[model samples]
Target: MKTLLSTIFSLLILAVPFFAQGQQTLLLVGGGQRPQEALKEWVKANPAKEPKVLIITWASANKKQAYETSIQADLREIGVRQFLFSQDITNSFEKNEFVNNLSQATHIFFSGGSQTLIMNILNSDPQLMNQLQHAYWKNNIPVAGTSAGTAVQAELMITGDTKNLEYGLGFLPKTVIDQHFFKRGREDRLRSFMKQAPGNFTGIGVDEDGSILFKRDPKTKEFNSTVLGSKNIMVIGPEINQFRQEKILRPTLLCSQLF
Candidate 1:
């Protein structure tokens, strides 16, 4: 326990130099499927250190040993070595153990499940969240999430219901992310958020087997987003409210493509 705390402290101390580098990269995948291309890109992007991928399954309710074994085997077939799976987390020891693993991680992947469950657990444990932020933003490690995992990355988290979005970890501000968009017919729900939003916020909706890769240009300091996988990625918002009489009009939404 003492050694674990010391390791975390050392990692935080070492991250000071890279703290201002901005977001490293983000791969957000819609629920219902996992795209192999996204995983390949994530592995290829890590030139900082040895490629070590950690999978967090806190959002998942059932703890199946076979699930972990299968995922590990699949990732291995695609050139990913050094794989780790963490689930059913409850105490500081478990959280600290996860933090220790982050020290060597080149990428972190969050599995699909309930967005609310993800937030409730992470929020209650700031220590774990802080370490995540340090590894992602400070240490410049890439991170990916699918389904509910994708939704929790936005500042305003869509609850997959008509109710207002809950506060998220805010990894990506000025954006609201929803998964299984077309598959679950969630376009109407995303529209509701825009209609009621006081300030303009971008809504990113990804369908099953689809994902978006977000990266910052090292030279220009600008962010670029690209679509990946076989399906479409929808981008809405930057809402333009032109009031004609009592009605408001917003620009038509569109989808984009990528190689």
Candidate 2:
């Protein structure tokens, strides 16, 4: 643990010196299907640190050893040549090991499964999270999560409750993300869910075998999104209101207008 902390601190210091010189590239992949090719392409193109992967078990949302093992192997085959995902995660020792591994990785790949569980792990670890925050702001290491992982990236995760959206460890503050969009008929529920939204969050729903990769332009400080393996990444923004009014306008709605 001591060794890990020292290492994380050293990375933080390095990021500062580089900032005075220039910016670093950050990638955020909303999980789904296979993202290995994209990762390889990104690393091959970028001159930053070697692309390393972190397959968080927290998102796997499972305690079954067999299930976790399967996820690990699947990720390895996908080009996570250097990674922290391994074996069964059933205790703090394993958790610490994962955190320490995250300290060095340039990329974070969240596997599909449970969002709440992952959020809890992050919430439970103060020291580990401290390292993550430092690594994020100082180094601008790219962060990506798929399915439940993607859900947690939103300002708040909808913890299986339509009445009340649960609190999430916010990464992207704009909106909540839903995976397997069209096939699952999430439109109605998502539409209703947005009605209770506290702010203007872009509701992003992706289909199976689909994903979103965000390009963090070091020079522009803007995160532009690109979709892969599918068509029409649904964006529930202000146009939604125009969509509603253009068809059937209604009153007594309390929420931010989305396009």
Candidate 3:
């Protein structure tokens, strides 16, 4: 796993020159409610320089205008003005339109709901998926997601119900995120993922009000994570060699209040 992480880190450094901008940022929020500190940081990042924002609600079951309106009002309170809303993508035109629209967005956020729904929609349209990749990878737009929205950002996504882990949008290729961590006892599923993951992937378990902030260094190609909100962030990685009693710990998960 360490070797895999090293290889990926090296690759990211090499690929830095290909991107139009410098650094990429991601904010992953745990399910339920957003913490005040996380919300404050998100709002502060919303400068006039990057005014355009896209909010995706496809994961949300309540795809009504009222729900969107409520979200808009909350964002507006934080000084956000320009906005684009996406509830569903059915036709080719909408899909194409979404791809084109991403070019103008400075920030993109996915709302909370079912991760499966978001994956199904994104996978159904290859163009949309490609466009999103370009927007974040090359364009340097910051992407944020909550709940199921956070889950889909990993390459290996938890199905929520099943013990299996399937493909996700994978914005954070090296990490897998789970929401409502301690409250719902989802650590076991994450352990299952670590056991079955194809490559070196870090498992991040977030409490209902917790969030994980990720930033990539353009020069060194290193990634740093900071834990925010109340509660704690759980990190699970490859088993380490411990020569205490010759007892090999099968699963090694660490819990910390901060990253």
Candidate 4:
């Protein structure tokens, strides 16, 4: 019985890599002035000839229009022609329509605001969350987010106060994501959170104006992270309790090459 259990455990460990196959690209931007180069990378990730970008502004309330306008201008500059805003898709009557629209989107972006608001809405409806997972995992559509939007990408998300942790959208598994790293002086906060966190998860603290692009290698079936933008990105592994800062001098660099 002991030998059989060991064999089963080994098989499950080997199957992990296969389960992570076919995941699409994820672009996580640290809140602040979004680098134009990051936007270009996002636009380039879309494989569609006529890419339809969907902007989810559930995190923003008063700044929804402003955020949409700014993102639209940036996306337009990068040759994006079609755009869909989720401002009106709030009620039950529009849920099906929103899901349909998400299916057609070549790229999905979440605007910065409050991660709590985004999760609250998503958690209330399982169908919406499933559709988003389908779009990102099965459909291979690129998903991008900034600030609070970026926080939701992780399974463990640091709250606004930097004191408590909450369950996020789980787009990025077994990871704790924090934004505004240096500017907000959040290194200590992240370290504390990581210590209290349940599982052995890596903590990623993205500085303002910095971005991390997570793309899966088709052959290896493993996600390779690339640092983009002008500032530094802090990565704390489960084993390494100390902070490791990686400065991005160039436009793009693989995290594998760095650490």
TM-score of each: 0.80, 0.69, 0.79, 0.84
Write candidate 4's Cα lDDT for 71-114 as tens digits: 88888877899998786446876777678778778999999999
- Mind sharing the TM-score for model 1? 0.80
Query: What lDDT does the true structure give each of the candidates?
Result: 0.66, 0.52, 0.67, 0.74
lDDT per residue, candidate 1, 1-259, as tens digits? 1110000000001112245475567788887556666667767777744577888787767743644665566567668888776775687787777877778677888777787878888788777778787777777788888888888888788885448877776666666788898899887777777555444566777888777777765445444665666666666655455321111111113332211
Model 3 C-alpha lDDT versus the unseen true structure:
0.67
Give the top-scoring candidate (TM-score).
Answer: 4
Which 10 consecutive positions of candidate 1 have the poorest summed lDDT? 3-12
- Find the candidate with the highest lDDT and give its number: 4
TM-score: model 3 vs. ground truth: 0.79
Q: Per-residue alpha-carbon lDDT of model 3 for 186-255, expressed as tens digits?
A: 7776776777774445677877766766667766766555566555666676344421111111112332
Candidate that beats the other on TM-score, 1 or 4, i.e. the better one = 4
Position 100, candidate 4: lDDT: 72
- Residue pairs clashing in model 2 are 31-145, 31-146, 237-258, 237-259, 238-258, 238-259, 239-259
Better of 2 and 3 by lDDT: 3
Model 2 lowest lDDT segment of ten: 1-10
RMSD of each: 10.3, 11.1, 7.6, 9.5
Per-candidate total of colliding backbone pairs: 0, 7, 0, 0
lDDT ranking, high to low: 4, 3, 1, 2
